[model samples]
Target: MQLVDFFTLLFMLMGVVSAVLVAFHPNVLYAAVALVFSLLSVAGLYGVLGADFLAAVQLIIYVGGIIVVILFAIMMSENIYRARFRDAAGKFVIPTAVAALLIAGFLKLFHDAKLETRAGLNAIPTTEQMGRALVGPYALVFQYVAIVLLAGLIGAVVVARPHHGNPESEAEKK
Candidate 1:
C-alpha cells in the first residue's frame, strides 16, 4: 500500500476511536480531550485530502478555539464529579434504529449507483478561491457564522456563571 493510504487508515482509526471515547467515556474532562483528538484526526484527514486551508482551519477553529472553550466549560462547571456520563439502554434504542436505517439506505444507494473508479483525481487547491468566495459573495453567511459563535460563547459564559440568589452554595455570596 502507498504511504498516503497508510496514513489515511491510521488517521481514520484515530478519529473513530477518539469519537467513540468522546461518547462512552465516563469522565467529562477525558471526553473533551478525546474530542480534541478526534478533531485533530479530522484535520489530518483534511491534510491527506490536500485541502491545506481546510486542515489549518479545522486545527485552528475546532481544535484550538472550540475545544478550549469546551474544556473551560467542562472545568468551570461545579458538579463535574457528580455527573453521570452513561446513557440508559432505552435511550440508545431509537438512535440506533435510526442509524441502522440511514446506513442501510446509504448502502442501497451506493450499490445501485455502481460508481466507477475514476482515474487521475485532479487535486484542486481551493484556498484562494474559497477565500474570495467567502469574502465576496458569501460574506453575509460568514458574518452570520461569526455572530452565532459569539452568541454561543456569550451563552456559555452566562450559563457557567454562578447564580446570585441561590442559597444552596457558599460560592456566590454577592
Candidate 2:
C-alpha cells in the first residue's frame, strides 16, 4: 500500500480505538484524554483526505478550543473528580441497537448508491481560495458569524461574572 493509504488506515484505527476508550473508560479524566486522541485522529484523517482547511479547523476549534474548555471545566469542578459514575443495568441495549441499525442502513445506502469517481484530480490549496471567498462574495456571512461569536463571548462573560447585587451575598462577603 502507498504511504498515504497507510497513514489513512493508521488514523482510522487511532480514531476508532480512542473513541471506544472514550466511551467505555471508567475514569472521566481518562475518557477526556481519550477524547483528545479521538479528535486528533479525526484531524489527521481530514489532513490525509487533503482537506487541509477542515483539518486546521478541526484542530483549532474542536481540539484546541472545545477540548480546552472541556478540560478547564472538568478541572475546575472538584466534585467531578470525587464522583464515581455508574451506568444502570441494560442501559446500553437500546442505544446499541439503534447504532447497529443506523450502521446497517448506511452500509445499505453505500452499497446501493452509484458514486462517481474522478481521476487525476490534484489536491489544491484551499486556504487562499477560502480566504478570498470569505473576503469577497461571502464577506457578509463571515462578518455575521464573527459578530455572533463575539456576542456569545460577551454573554458568557456577563453570565459568569459574580452577582454582587444581592443583600445576602453582600452580607456574606462582609
Candidate 3:
C-alpha cells in the first residue's frame, strides 16, 4: 500500500537482476556496469528503508569511489581488451554447494533453537553513537584501516610500476 514498500520491492528486484547479470556476463566491462547498477539499486533500497545517510554514503563512497577505481583499474591493466573473459563458475560449484549446505545447517540450528529477540532492552543504532564508538573505543581500528589503505596504494604503484625494468630487456621479453 505504501510507496516506500513498492519502491523497496522494485529496487530489490532490480538489484537482484543486475547482480545476476554481473555474475553471468561474459564481458568484464558489461559485468562492471551491471554491478554498478546493482549497487545503486541496493542504495535505493537503503533510502526506502529510511537510512538516508547509509544510502548516500553507499552511493557516494562505494558506487562512486570503489567502482570507479575498479573500472579504471580494468581499463589500465594489460591485455584487457584483447583477453577473453573466462567463466569460472565450474571452479566454484563444489565449494559453493558445501557452503550452501553449511549455511542451511546454521539456519536450521537458528530456527530450531527458537531465539526470541529482546526488543525493548535494545535501542535502534544511531550514527552518532556509532561514530563515537568508532572514534573513541575503536580508534585503533581507524588507524589500522588508514595503514591498510596506504599499503594498498603502495602495492598498486609497485605492481603497476612502468619503471621497474629496462626498456631494452622488457622489449626483448615481449
TM-score of each: 0.69, 0.77, 0.65
Residue 168 accuracy (lDDT) in model 3: 71
Writing each residue's lDDT as its tens digit, candidate 1 over 68-160 gives 999899899998866757636368879889989998999999999966431244457879899999999999999999999899999999998
lDDT of each: 0.86, 0.85, 0.81
How well does candidate 2 match the true structure in TM-score terms?
0.77
- Pairs in steric clash, model 3: none
Q: What digit string (tens of lDDT, one per residue) describes model 3 on residues 1-174? A: 677668878998999999989877777878899999999998997676656678889999989999999999889878765554464646877867997999899999998996644322233445787689789999999999999989999999987766546897577667
Give one digit per residue, the lDDT tens place, for model 2 in 17-59.
Answer: 9999987887677788999999999999878777799999999
Better of 1 and 2 by lDDT: 1
Model 1 lDDT, residue 105, Cα: 100
Residue 87 in candidate 2, Cα distance off native in Å:
3.4
